[model samples]
Target: MFFCLLSFYGGNGYAENDLQRDNPLEQYRQLFAEQQKEFEKQRRIIEEQGKEIEILKARINSLAAQSPSSQPPATEANNDQTVIAATSPKKKIEIPSKPVGQAPPQASEKPRPPEIPRLSETVGGVLTRKGNLVIEPALEYAYTDNNRVFLDAFTFLPAIAVGLIDLREIKRHSFIGSLAARYGITDRLEFEFRAPYVYRSDSQRSRAVSIGVGEDEIFNASGNDIGDLEFATRYQLNSGSGGWPIFVGNMVATVPTGTSPFEVDFVQSTPGAVFPTELPTGSGYFSFQPSITALYPSDPGVFFGNLSYSYNAETNENVGKVDPGDAVGLSFGMGFALNARSSFSLGYSHKHVFESEINGQTVNGSELDIGQLLIGYSFRFTPKTNINLSLGIGTTEDAQDIKLNLRLPMTFDFLSQAY
Candidate 1:
């Protein structure tokens, strides 16, 4: 009886061990199903978040389209998109659409150099945009004084002459008001037209050479008329990339429309003294000038230079066929941007004129040298309007003593409808 009872207990214990093993396998199957469901829920959440991101991106783009200026910079937008993507699920890297080994297209709206003050009328500070027009009204004033001594007889010693001596002093004043219009055909090419009105006055004092006169006689003359008309075209030669200088080519032409010196009447003031009854308003001949300007932008300042050549056409005058002298010019300067709306320029200008010809004969002692120091300032009053002022001081006898120029430029866009 005892042996049978022990065998029964051992069988019961083995049965309990088998049941425990089966329960564990069933539990494992249930745990696996729960884990799979959790994974599916997470995947659905990721898809929903991605769709929300797409909707947000569309809304942002719509707002940007309505107000273009309100849009952020390209770099900033790209960085924001990168941050958004990093916070989400990982994605496969995409290949670029462009072909491999090909260089990227250069950007047309690259950073441009700062604008400088205008040093010359032919060379403007900045170019007008395409399909735009700029109208500039300007005023100028100049003053000069000249003194001359004429000795009719040969000099016997260092400061002594046996013949008559004539002493004269001349003071001149000039004023000009002009209107100019500039039109941009393309981003790199422009045309300009300018018309000027001039007024002049002169005073001359002379001592009689024939008599031993201690008193000087004074003569006065004045004139006012329309001055020469001018036309100009400018073209940009380069894009100024890769640390290269910007180059511009300019062509200017002048039409003679004012009163010429030869057309003016003269009166005899005293013995061996003659003066114009009315001062001249313009040169007698037409002129054409070609010039090149170079600009290099270094930090905090800009270095600029210009070279030019002028040719005067021959004309028939009352005396003879008069040919004005040709001239060569050189100028260099540095400009600083004082602020966003203001700038300053300092420069030097020089010109050398060849001898003139009368009736196909070269006139003796007719060559001249002109030099001046220039200072310019520019201020922008609005987005489309600005004022520029410049002062010139003569450094040579042939140049004017002092010159002041003021210009106000206003711009209008003609292609805004296309946008």
Candidate 2:
């Protein structure tokens, strides 16, 4: 009985062990099924995201079409073209009912190729950079009233007033002529000289004022050939592509070369419109004038306007120092590049004297106003030589009512030989 009982116990133990061994295998199968389901879910999500990306890309193209920089007027706009192509659903396809006398084809399922990401688009464009070097000759004239600053340097005004000169259409004629030469060292650097011809009392018909104490002052020489000459140099500090703004600077000196109408009668005359009451050339004095300017350009390669301010220093006379008389000027210009060999320009200039003082005294005498118009053109006959022609017409409150200037300049190239 005892042996039979032990055998029964051993058999029961074996059966329990077999059952436990199968538990691990069954758990493994269940876990595998769960993992497969997760993988399929992720794949579907990825496909849906791809379609969304395509939709976003199409939207971007639509927005680009509406922007201001869009293609030219004639080019057809394609706002929704991309979206339609991307989002349209495919039509159903039916299997061909086997063509007559053709072998039936076996259908094998295969994976489809993945969708590609939208990359950047193709564009065509151009950039332009060009420059020009020119040689020019220029002439200028200016006039003013009030003997205090003119005939007599004594009280900032000449006390005696004689007969005024010729007048036309409510304007007086104070005339001066100049001969100038200009050479462009580069697009940025320049060297120029201007020699002005004086209008002597006998050279032209004009009036003379006297200077002295209160009432009847002494007589003086006629105001002719009393103006001075100027020499200047300019440099372009900044210039980008033709479409951008530009900046330039200039330095100038005025030499005492003209006649002196004041010293003749030696009255109260000392200060005038850049003219000295003493002998011609006002003690051979020296002055410095600097100018800074800004420019803006327009299309059609022509319309560009510039404005500038010139700072002038007064003459150094041992008797007394004269305060600086400066000017504010504006220029409006238009030009056309006729061809590779020629160009044309039209412009207007207006200037005003801001303030002045004589011998440390603020005398409210007169303000000098000037207006002028310019028309000019340049031509190049050969690579070695060129000609520039220019003319100027006075508008009002100036030295002359009519004036014309012309220029012809040639260029020599040391760089050409190397190229």
User: Which predicted model would earn the best lDDT?
Assistant: 1
Which parts of model 2 are misplaced by more than 4 Å? 1-187, 193-231, 255-285, 293-300, 316-319, 339-341, 415-419
For candidate 2, which ten residues in a row score worst on lDDT? Answer: 118-127
TM-score for each predicted model, relative to the true structure: 0.73, 0.46
lDDT of each: 0.84, 0.49
Candidate 1 residue runs with Cα over 4 Å from true position: 1-107, 110-114, 151-164
Candidate 2 C-alpha lDDT tens digits along 1-419: 88899999998999878876867987788789999999999999889868876765654455444534443243222334434444444532221222324455679532111111100000000000012233333333433332222332334336544532221112223444555555555545666676665542211112233322233223323355545677777666664354555555667777766653223433233222122233342324456656554444444344444455656666545446666567777766666667777776777777786666678776564467777776766677687455655565667744345555444444444445447
Candidate 1: residue 360 lDDT (0-100): 90
Cα distance off (Å), candidate 2, residue 276: 11
Error of 2 at 287 (Å): 3.7
Instruction: Give every collision pair in model 1.
Output: none
